[model samples]
Each structure stands twice: as structure tokens, then as C-alpha cells.
Target: MSQHESRWSLAHTGNRILLAVIAGALIACLCGGTDLPVATQLVILLGVGGVTYALVTLLHRTRR
Candidate 1:
């Protein structure tokens, strides 16, 4: 129905942001050269995710 189409067309910002964060962390993990300890890996993911979220936010702001 047109109602469903309208709802689907309106993107939910929060989900998009979470996806961006996860994608950033995943890309970082895949591209990292060094084999770090589990704890270090967690830290790396956190750092990359934070940076990615910031960049995404900046980009989204600029696009608006």
C-alpha cells in the first residue's frame, strides 16, 4: 500500500548510524595488518567505530 511505501521511504537515522559504526569496525578489522591480542582488537574496534561514527555524522550534517 502507499502507506507502507511512505514509511519505508523514510529512512531511520539511528539504524543507519549503527550500521555505519559496525561497517567501520568491520572494515578496520579486515584491513588491519597486525595480529593483536583479543583485548587490543576490542580496543581497535572501538576506536575505529568511534571515528567512523564521527565521520558519518559530519557527512550527514553536510548533506542536509
Candidate 2:
């Protein structure tokens, strides 16, 4: 692929990862400072992150 395409792909991936990390942190906060189950919280966080990433990618692509 061309340099531009590669850059765009990298940008998209970076955005997804950044958003996912933020979402995970938010989820961790929502879980509170307790020693309880974490799997569910993690799943929810990941789901939200994935959706956000997808929407962002779509918007970026369309705007181009």
C-alpha cells in the first residue's frame, strides 16, 4: 500500500487502542475500589470501546 494509506490505517488503529484504554479505565472506575468480580466489567468496557472505535473509523473514512 501507499504511504498515505498506511498512515491512515495506523491512525485508525491508534485511535481504536486509545479509546479502548480510556474505556477500560472508566469501567475500572465504575467497578469501584472493591475486590469483586471483574470479568463483566471488563467485557462491558471492551464492548463500548469496540463500538466507539468502529464509529470513529467510519466517521473518519466518510469525512475523507
Candidate 3:
């Protein structure tokens, strides 16, 4: 595929991964993540996911 298409694909994959990770984490929390460690881990997961998603999106946009 072309470079642009490749970038789009990468961004799409990143977005899917981000969503899946967040969803799974939330579900876990609902199931039994009622501890300080779980809460802290959730915060870290969210922060990392957010940054990675943003970076992937930015990369796609800048390449365009």
C-alpha cells in the first residue's frame, strides 16, 4: 500500500487497541477492582493509552 494508506492503517490499529484496552480495564474494575492498586494501575493505563493514541493520530495527520 501507499505511505498514506499505511499511516492510516497504523492509526486505525492504534485506535482499536486503545479502545479495547480501556474497555477491558473498565470491565475488570467493575468486576472486582476495588483496591488502591487497581485504581492506580487504571490511572496509569489510561494515561499511557491516551498518550499513545494521541501520538498515533498526530503521526497520521502530520504525514498527510
lDDT of 1 by residue, 1-64 (tens): 4434233221456755686678767866775767767677777777777776677667767765
At residue 62, candidate 3 shows an lDDT of 98
Model 1 residue pairs with clashes: none
Which candidate model has the greater TM-score, 1 or 2? Answer: 2
The clash tally of candidate 1 reads: 0
How good is model 3 by TM-score? 0.52
For residues 1-64, what per-residue lDDT tens digits would candidate 2 score against the true structure? 6555565352668856787678767876777666656776777777877877777777767877
**Residue clash pairs of candidate 2:** none
Please estimate how well model 3 matches the true structure, expressed as its whole-model Cα lDDT: 0.64
For model 1, the run of ten residues with the poorest summed lDDT:
1-10
Which residue ranges in model 1 land beyond 4 Å of their true spot? 1-13, 28-34
Candidate rank order under lDDT:
2, 1, 3
Clashing pairs in 3: none
Candidate 1 lDDT for residue 41: 73
Q: Which stretches of candidate 2 lie over 4 Å from their true place?
A: 1-12, 33-36
The TM-scores of all predictions, comma-separated, are 0.58, 0.61, 0.52
Ranking by TM-score: 2, 1, 3
> What's model 2's TM-score?
0.61
